[model samples]
Target: MIAIETTGLEYTYTDGTNALSGVNFEAKEGEKVAVLGPNGSGKTTLFYHFNGLIKPTRGEVRVFGESISKNNIDKIRKRVGIVFQEPDSQLFAPTVYEDIAFGPKNLRLGSMEIKNRVTQVLHRFEIEALAQKNPSNLSGGQKKRAAIAGVVAMEPDILVLDEPTSGMDACGITGTMEILDELNDEGKTIIISTHDCDLAASWADRIYILNKGRVFKSGIPKHIFADEKLIAEAGLKQPVIVQTYREFRARGISRGEVPLSVLDFMDSVDVKVMNIRCAIAGCDVEAGDEVCLEIKNGMLIANKGSNGVTGRAVFDGKKGEDIAVRDVAGDILQHEGTITIIRVPGIIEGGSRAADLDRVRDILSKNKHQKMGAMGTSAKVLMTRLGLVCDFEFDVIQSGILAALRGFDVTILASGGMADRVAEKVKEKKLKYSCFVL
Candidate 1:
């Protein structure tokens, strides 16, 4: 079922301000969609139509394929629960429990059901401790949580939030996103409206950009961010990773796949042009040679004659830690005919942006470089830590390319992505190169 749909939606305030104009919005069941726009772009107005809070001035709003109207307003409200951007505007009770109970009470549910629903939402939001506390006196983040709890307590099929992380600190934003993810995992259709391009780039499965009270663009994060003209018209900036992609593409580099997040960019960029041999698993020990093997990136190289520093290098760019290379290279420096292998974990593209952030942080901490610059949202979480300017690339691929161009003969390359595929194709074409490790 279409959880929410708006066709030719238009709304005009009594003050004669056209809030929405010919908007056609849609969200399928169990979808996690984001509505992105700058301020005064009709995001709030569009959300109001979903729950029957406001009647459309022109077309109509539908909940589960049913048109919203006075006859079914109650049913629509029960199905679509909206949490306003400002907690103070939605939360209006002496205690958190009372505020949360307000919606169920309006539903006229049985006393036991209301009590159970209240308890569930409190526990779900981890705010049972605040049940008896006055919401008005709570912290801004706490109040935001309470406000959301009230809407969630209604047990709606669709949950709509307006700038959910809007006035939150770093920790608050993290916690809120976790809760939203949890709810989505439980099969609830989730829609969020925000002006945060960074958040939308990383979190949303699909994006809808609003401009001048209409949808300026609607598509996947990769495609939407790739359109520089649409991004500018929608009052948004391309995500940092997308910006980097444009820079790479402009320079005639092609990944054949556009990435939506920093981790995806790290994994998907065009590293083929470096022309190094494919990565292999193990190599036979050679005589009279110091082989410093680096298993960190799952790349194995056969050392024939290039013996300068013979030690393997593993740098995640973000951490600026070359300790793996330094340690093995130091040992090889003392003893000319020694071999060593080390494993280094780095950025991985997980299912969600939050997961990727955790992965990046894990890589940093595991590398024993914990003191990184603000590792929250944005490419800065990885970019700033890597200390990379435009002339420099943070990923290993670019570093290797630069090394090859600088006359350092690269022996081999390995990857779980395009590199692996390219290597197989090379083998088919009878082009001699390294094969898989395992």
Candidate 2:
């Protein structure tokens, strides 16, 4: 189902400035869509049409198959929440808590329900500490979080964010994206306009490039970034990952689909294992022999022997690397490690219990060697409150899977829908894993 669609969208300011012209766009239900463009490219103007913030000068804007108009504008606004590029534009209440409670109050929700919604958003956005602070007194990133929380408090089905991470720090950006992913998992359509090419490539399901008040190109990230001419013509730089992947392909080091992330790039590298003469004296190895491979002094060494042929694993290796090799058939070794997922629940109706934290601690103590990761806002907040640090923070799911492939035990803490996402990604990688809920 299409959540939002615009046909021949044209918006002109009162001062004779045309912000959007013949812009046709659509965002599917529960999709993560990105609108990319340089400044003054009509990205903001197009976003305003999604929620009926501004009427188009020409053409139509539809939300959930209904044309947006004054008769249904109130209902449409309730269904589609918009977070502006500038936090100050959205936040005006005396306190952050009030700012978040504004939307729900306008909906005439019960006072208790409105309070609950504001509280949930504050905690979800990790802005609970700033709830009572004046919005004008908060930092740039804090103000952004407060603004987003204000919109999310309305529980809109479609979230439209303009430059959501414009003033955020690295950690703030990661946490915000994780929260958005969690919302999307729960079937919210997430539409964001950003100048960050790398973020759009890695996070968005589809991207639309806007130029001169029109959509210059629209496609998946791989195809959008692969066209150097299009990128240059739009006055945008290719994502760093795409640039690096192109260079690797040119150097004959990588093949297959263009990589959009670090994990994809690693998967694209063509690492080949070659059979070579035994480097160790008096050592013999044959095909179809079981041998233990370990990295010693930056070299992959086969310890056991059989028929004078030592399998040389020609790939990057570091000292102290010990990956158990079960079979050496055709000089290929199979290696795998366990991945354990811990599902952290959202804030309980009353409050979370200390037993939950204890359970997590017990799991951590049992898996001392496991690389720990937390996915989504709830999981990260729980980990932080428990005084536990995560080894993988930004790309927790892919990072955990990568570590498991490298023969390292991984423990991921995920909340709500993200737990299912972690399991799905791990299953896609064909790795054995376990999940526990606390």
Candidate 3:
């Protein structure tokens, strides 16, 4: 189902500034959509229309197939929550607790129910310590979290965040995005506006490039970023991973699809190694011949001995075929590590699953040299309660894959949809690694 849709959305300011023009957009149920644009683009203006905060001048905005009107404006707002770019614009309550409770109170929910919602959000966002703090005194990241918590307390089905990590540090950005992912896993439609191309490429399932009050392009991140001309025309730089992949491709070092993350890049490197074959005819070297191999001008060059050789390659010959070199430039990854995923229940139900926790403990104890990671809010919170120290908190799936590539077994704790996501990413690597989900 379409959670939100806009047809020919046009918005004009009181000063006659046209903010959006003839824009058509839609977000499916339980999808993560990203709106990317330069400054002064119609990103935020389009977002305001999602929840009736701003009505179009000559278009229509629909939430769940229902047009927005004053009669149902309140209902629309209740189902669509917007977190502005600037938290100061949305946060007005004296204390963080009160600010979060404000939305639930407006719903006419009982005081106890409101309290429970606020408390749950506080802990969910890891802002419990800031519950009594003044919003005005909180840090920029804290304010952002508080504002989002307030909106989430209303239990909206659709979440629209404008520059959700604009002022956050690296750690803050990762934590915030993880929380958003967890919300998305719980069936909320997440729509965010961001200038961070890297974040959009890695996090969003679909992207809309808004330019000059219109959508310039819309597609999956891989296709959207792969177009060099489109990125240049959109006035955006390629994401770091994409840029690196292009450089490797240009240098004849890496091939295959454009990688979106470090883990993907590592997999590409492995594929390149697996595909390298000896080009010289009748050049046969016995095992342990100490032959040297070097990549010069995009071609692999092999020599007789290691005296002048830059690297070593493992040769495996097939009938009537040239010898295939497996490891051309680096140490052969002979023993690929295993990735073990443990799916824990949500935080509220975590305490009731003591057996699961014991199983996790047993797994951890057995894997002495394994790297530990956690994904989703529930798994992180459960690990914290269990006094477990996670080596990878943010980007757990990619981190686990990278660690496994380096021959270290990995144990990842994830919940709900995240466990499946981990499995999907692991399958993409195509390495000889074992993934067991508990």
> Where does the lowest 10-residue lDDT sum fall in candidate 1?
337-346
lDDT of 3 by residue, 1-438 (tens): 999999999999999999999999999999999999999998989998898887799989989999999899999999999999899999998899999999999999999999889988997788999999999999998899899889989989999999999888888889889888888888999999999999999999999999999999999998998898999999999998988888988877777888888876865664434444463312455444445554332234455555433333455333333444434444434436777777666544542143366777776787643678888777877788779789986688888887777667778888667778888877877544444444
Query: Which lDDT tens digits does candidate 1 get at residues 1-438?
Result: 888899999999999999999999999998889999888999998988888888899998888999987798888888889999889999888999999999999999999999988987786576889999988899998998899889988878899999898887776676577567556655789999987787888778899988889888898887887678888877787777777877877776647566665545644555444222222223433233334432332233333234533443332221221222322332111211111111111112221222334444444444422111211122222343345232222233333332332323222222123244334433432322332221
For model 1, the stretches where C-alpha displacement exceeds 4 angstroms are: 248-254, 271-438
lDDT of 2 by residue, 1-438 (tens): 999999999999999999999998999999999999999999998998888888999999999999997899999999999999999999999999999999999999999999889988888898889988999999999999899999989999999999999989999999899889988987899999999999999999999999989999999998998888999999899988888888988878788887888878877876552233232212344434445453332234565544332343333233334332332334221355778888887444223342377787787777634578988767877778887789987788888888777667888988777889899989977777888888
- Whole-model lDDT per candidate: 0.63, 0.82, 0.80
Candidate 1 Cα deviation (angstroms), residue 206: 2.1
| All models, RMSD in angstroms | 12.8, 5.1, 7.2
lDDT rank, highest first?
A: 2, 3, 1
Tell me which of candidates 1 and 3 scores higher on lDDT.
Answer: 3
Please give the lDDT score at residue 196 for candidate 3.
Answer: 97
Q: Which regions of candidate 2 fall more than 4 Å away from where they truly are? A: 273-333, 346-369, 384-387
| TM-scores, all models, native as reference | 0.65, 0.85, 0.85
Query: What are the per-model numbers of colliding residue pairs?
Result: 3, 1, 0
Q: In angstroms, what RMSD does candidate 1 have relative to the true structure?
A: 12.8
